[model samples]
Target: MPPRTEAHAEQQPAAVAVGKATPAAEVEPPGKVQVTVGGAEEAGSEGEDDDDDFDWGAAKHIFVLSNAGKPVFSLSGDEQRLSTLMSLIQGMLSLCADCDNGDEMESISAGSRRFVFLKRGNLVLVGVSSSLVETASGDEGGEGGEGTGKEEDEAAAAAAAPECESFMRLQLEYLYASILFLLTSKVQGIFLKSPGYDLRGLLGGADTSLRGIIELAEPSRGRGRMLAGGVETVWMDPAIRSRVARNLQAAQTASAPSGALYAVWLCGEKLVALAQPRAPSHHLSSRDLLLLVNYVATQPALRNAESWTPVCFPRFQKTGYLYAYIGFLEDPPSSTLPRPPPQGNADQNSPPAQHSDATAGTGSIADENEGRRGGSASADGGTQSNGSGSRSIERDSGTEAGGAAGDSCVILVSVESSSEQFQAFRRTRSALESRFRSALGTHWDRYLGSGAELEREGILTKFCTQMKALHFHYCLRGKQGGAPCVTQCLSSPFVDHELASNPAAQHRVWGYYTRAALRVRRGSCQEGRVFCRRRFEGNNGYFGGGGGDGRGSGSPAEEGNGASEEELATALFESDPVHSLAYEVGDEHTVVSLFGKRDGGAGGGGRWVSSSSAGTGRLGGGDELHVCFPSSVSPEDAYKAAVRLTAIVRRDRDWLFLTGTGAAK
Candidate 1:
């Protein structure tokens, strides 16, 4: 796939036809094959593809499959069928819309089912399913939701550990809460962290990063059988996530968990947070730098846990303040390592009625004979590619970002590098968060002294200490009956979006972190396959090659002139969320982000003066980039650009027939 040239015109709104799946390319030197870029693509309606009918009966099949008669244990076939059905529906939503123009369609899963839509795009979707025992959705069998509120309230009150309260309540709420009603005509798209957190329906007008995160996720894929079991929101103070790092050190356990609890959640292309744990033994040693460097290469990716490995986000020492690297995927690339900003999602104070997380107001009216679960499409997640020019990465600077990570969680690096790391880190962190939550709930404070809260909760400090040292590396992802998961897009049912053969349109695939994850138009059909597209642009041959010579693919007319770089590539599929949709241009492959690439793609994505420079980061031989809408551009430009893109790759085609059916004869 070519590097993802997400050079859409964001200043103004425009309609953009979908692009295609190209591999993430590598970067070389400038004056060579350069991928010139303009503003982000315009916005347009992504007309829905043909969708398969929803199967409402699978729920019963699932109950039978479990043989336990306990519905919760059984992943109802009906749900899977509906999920597949919804994937088809929302995936092609734009085609169904009356408006010729389209909206952003970010993906978010609230309740049991996953969802697809846009954040600010033209479409929105809301999905609900059952997996979480008490999450926003409910199941008929076993220990699912339907528990008494009095019992839950009592449990919350009596729970000795403050942390435990959340588990008890979270589990129940996950099961019982009705899907919310955030999706409105005005909403661009709603992105739910997961069913557990998505109490309300799809929210309207969320941040662009939310859109970006999901867009980069499965452009059109989901796992109907899988479940992201955990809380959607973490109301605790930010410090808590970091503080645990310092706390790890103070305890002084022997075999400390090699990794810390660093988390990167770019749910909808938003680089949420990258927090590393700090052990008491942390030092500015080479080994530490290596660990940091490894992770440095991590966070800039799409933040999809399924594809990459995780690093215990390092922590700071001095102040109880554990510094973490936090930013929105939309932040400018030229800016400094950013501090945490306020939340950017839709209204959450009082979750919607369907998403009350208590009782599903009234049971959803079922058609009985054809029991299709009621749902909607919302926020989305995904994965895709790398794009850019070239770079002879020297080991010296490659480790720059690592050394600078420091004891403080402050991870300072260029925008390009950050984007890549964001992709990888987000994925790992999401997996960790989900797994950790499940572990703690199932183990019931297995780590005794691990935390003050756990200590007080009647868990042995020794056990807690031991528990904190290790983690759930997602070893069980595919342990069910076969090998483990390989990429983010291929997670069994819940995440599997039957791969479509159409061009790379909105919310079609599951991996790589780009905006594709959020663009489900509605009524799209699945092709059931993983795909790869290779697209390279012949540089102007600036690297001593013939000027204006075509080196990549396409023809003379397509190549054009003005020293355009090769079309960057990206590997977008249907599964995987919170990962990066990478891109690289010019001779330098560093991420040219609005935050740091102030010189435009000029300076090699410079390193942080501090430790971020340790590693000579090679982001597919390009600069670290962060897409930010320039205030100058007009929304009209975006609209026009989108229209142009659509025109470039329309779905159907026409040809002159030798003779008309009747008239010809």
Candidate 2:
């Protein structure tokens, strides 16, 4: 498969025609492909192909329409052609509008097709599905035979109706949320107010976002089995989440209006921290958050810098606008080691290019201190110390007057209208960011303990000491086809210290890490098969190759045509959320993120683990990090902390790719 692309435009809203569509097995005329509805398969003629199997029962089609019976959006089929069907649906819904039922419209079943409707003011969300399976009546025998009582069967059918209705309603809600994300409440209001407003034109760019929501809600998809409407959080210790929340809240307080709506910090695409007023009415819907995150993730321009955009939290107010100041934080790249001067003319007064501890094959963890004023690292007692000097904090200086973007957090602050209010908000945000930076610096100092040299002992000691602020960390590094190198904090539940101390046990653990990395890169999850479905199966090819590229059959290592350096780097460092995963594993919460290239494509991905660079072992090729914390932890903190580590990994590639006992040799 070819590597995935960056973004996809929203599909024009439309629905497939209701009918017995052609089956995959039957040979069709040129320019035609089989399209099925429900589970009824087309009887194929002799010599027809039948190898392709699709469960039509799992398919769902969604449509959005105005109360005027005009089509707004559709997830499948042709929109223009589905007007008649939509008119029929609208006509049916009109009859029920004057009934005793309140604003809501419950689902109605028409033969095999179930139509679920949700009325949101002037807009209507409709979900049509032929995949609803018949619920066995309570009176039915375990062997699929009828029970002796007719009343029991009737009661069972009644019992099953609610479940079916609930599922349909949920699907409708998903569609509505997706639309809100694309058009926002304010835009929707505008579209409604204007007579000639083309909702499709307003939703033109959101095709990918809409499709993602549909896939997430579809029962047949892997993510649907795992996540519902809630946001995907980076699992971290509660204490860390609290600290992050405090930071975000503090940031919000710096520039927030008296009625600020939401202040959130996103790491990659998952929400790691959020801050809001204590008012009871300040409830932020998880679905809204999810939708917003997905929207931002699809927007590549928002990744690198701070931007302010007019936004409407549809759940909060569907007809108004709020300005959101969005910015990102990233750990600055490590200062480059000065090149050695020519042997004869080297200046005797110049400071040595190398330190005593720095040697070939030995990776040095550089402190973030060198370039900034009053940033220093000490090696005594294994604790880092900041320089005793005053540092001026500055706000992000983007094209916009007041916003700033950096590597620490994805700051999203809401503000009221008016340039004066925006300027005030920017000042407030800058001051808050300064405070956050200072606090983060202090935290980094405590974690580093003296200097980067402390990491020389090994990956285990490095993780053990650096991650003392929270629970232990589990770090893994591996090549696409080779074994992985893994070391966890001594206190981790997954670690058996006695066995860990054993050389054989250590080798085994290393093997486990290697195998796990391979499995993840290959998208091999069976139970919570989220990545495999979204990436490998769907073949979005954002990082990996496209599925239609006709090369997905080979392993990632075998394909050797992964994303380019810039592409892989962007996937790792950019704000794309779909590339990351946050889900629960048993009682523990595990967040997984893939970095580097593993598309099995030949050249660009070769820079990852085990790939030779200047005849040295590669450190970060095909590397993926998984952090597991107690279920009590939230996913947000987990990601915030993980990204910091990733920043270090990005800088200290030499150390990570070490082949021998000591640094690169």
Candidate 3:
């Protein structure tokens, strides 16, 4: 394989790439379908990671552009390179490897999410299927543009090939897994705040109202029909399932709102399955989920709702990444989505001639620091502090690429919450803001609004509403060094600790995070433990625990009291699974289903039974039961990984740090 690095792409100019068409034009066949940057491929170095640190070398930033050739999203160095490159290949294959039956466009990877936006400043990607993918005359046929119509000849002209789908899936897998993986160094978010360039508009009309943030998009056709809820997936490979599960669990702890909590958990190929009863008041319909996805699509910092409950939550044996982002720690307290001034009808115009100079291989990550003179973070839509928090300019810059005159765009991310239910939310937001300020130190924008003065001058929102109590907003500047995307911070445990330990306010806090395993234990109310009362808003119910668990003590005694025979029988069978060899063991008592839980009751030796049900008159079952998980991992390995992470966090005092040698190799 070739080395994976953005530096390699810099060799080619941003102008006309074979796969990236400037505008719709007539077809001129190349007569061949091939994968080529038409240059040498760069290989990435590898290292052993004993802890959080995996020696990533110097970083670079690369751009991800839409088919129109406008940038959609951007990432730092190596990681960015990998993301963009994969996108290109997959995008090309999407158009190239497709077969059609002459008349309409037929896509192998068809779904509702085929919408494409002409992104200007950020990294957003969409793959579209095309006929005559190799034709170059489409955009050059004078004004209206024309195509050879060679692609429309027949769907049979092409055959379904696995290469494109496989490649695209793998790339999605990487991003869905870790956007920082290919990085030779810690990835930064500096590109998010660059001025001049137009980032895609974050649409915010109403608060995202799933259990968390909802992702919504106004499809060109669907009046309101767009992807809602989480991306459905099938997880079959054991290794992949474990990895995705671990990461998803950790990222959940980082979200601030109702978030993407697992109301229903179905785990097992051979284990006993059952539904956990979630609170009756917390039922969320498919509509509820759709709303959440809609909301998320409009938020900032979060590029996508990656951890939102997946549409296909428990796909038994297929391996893939499923999930979405709902509420984020940093959300818009007010309804002000960030957008750029349109140069005209934005979607219009054949994108600029693919100037070879704009391609990742030839484009320098940063322009000659030339016009990088100082500017106010408050200029137009900028970052500013609230209350007595004097504007420190913390850091400021002017690296943002804008229109012909070369101006900068502004963005504000609200960190503090506006509610009393979460004073902790406010404090943590402030701390994160502070860390961001410090991280960008010399690179912060001088103009714009901070936590307090956003709406006064910048394109921003404040944290406040009937949902909560206070007001807070954060300014994001895409400067030379002010790492902009704070969401990536979830990878740091120490940072999480600092934010989690706010002394100002408190209520229920759990079920959210960005890294590490956060096993949400359904606490017993009778045990008097305070279970953070965040509500669930989906179909699934919660389940698990044996008969003697929480359920055994709560059944009613009325003559008309109802207990379905199926439910009662399940409960009875769980009490003595030893009597039946066909049962799988698991708990069913304290189950709190989110979407929909599993089969009836719990089974396996894992079930708990009271002496009354066991026929042994033991009347004894411990509240705290032990379950064994067989892993190839030794206790020592787990200990080592934990200790290593702790040490790195202590040394760096930052949530993100390097664990392996400082060298790339």
* Global lDDT of each candidate: 0.21, 0.40, 0.21
- lDDT of each residue in 1-665, candidate 3, tens digit only: 11112111222221122222122221211221222222322222222221122111211112344333334343333323343343443454334323232111111221111112212123333333222122233234442234535444322222211112211222222221122111111112334444223223421122222112211111111111211111211111122222222323322243355322321111110000011113322222222222323333333323221122222211110122223312222222221233333221212222332223212121111221223333212111223223232112122223221111101111111122233213222233333333333332233322111221121111101011110111111111011012111000111111123322542111011101000001212211111111121111111112122122222211111011111222221112112112100111112101111110112222211323332342222112211111111133343432232222222222221111111110000
Tens digit per residue, CA lDDT, model 1, 1-665: 22222222122222221222111131121111111112222222211221232232121111100111111111222323233333333333433232334433222122222222221122122322212122222223223255657655433222211111111122212111101111222221222222222312232232222222222112232211011210011112122222322222222221122222333332221111232223212212111222233233334432211222212211112112222233222211112333222221111122323422221221111111022111211112223223221221111223222221111122322112333444433333333333323322222111111121322111111111222211000001111012111111111111112222432211111111122221111111111111111112122211112133321211111011111221111111111112222222211111111111111121112211211122212111111112111223343432232222212111100000000110000
By lDDT rank, best first, the candidates go: 2, 3, 1
lDDT minimum window of 10 residues, candidate 2:
4-13
Q: Candidate 2, after superposition: displacement of residue 111 in Å?
A: 5.5
What does the lDDT come to for candidate 2?
A: 0.40
Q: Candidate 3: lDDT over CA atoms? A: 0.21
Q: Give, for candidate 1, the lowest lDDT window spanning 10 residues.
A: 656-665
Query: What's the residue-level lDDT of 486 in candidate 1?
Result: 11
Which model, 1 or 2, shows the larger TM-score? 2
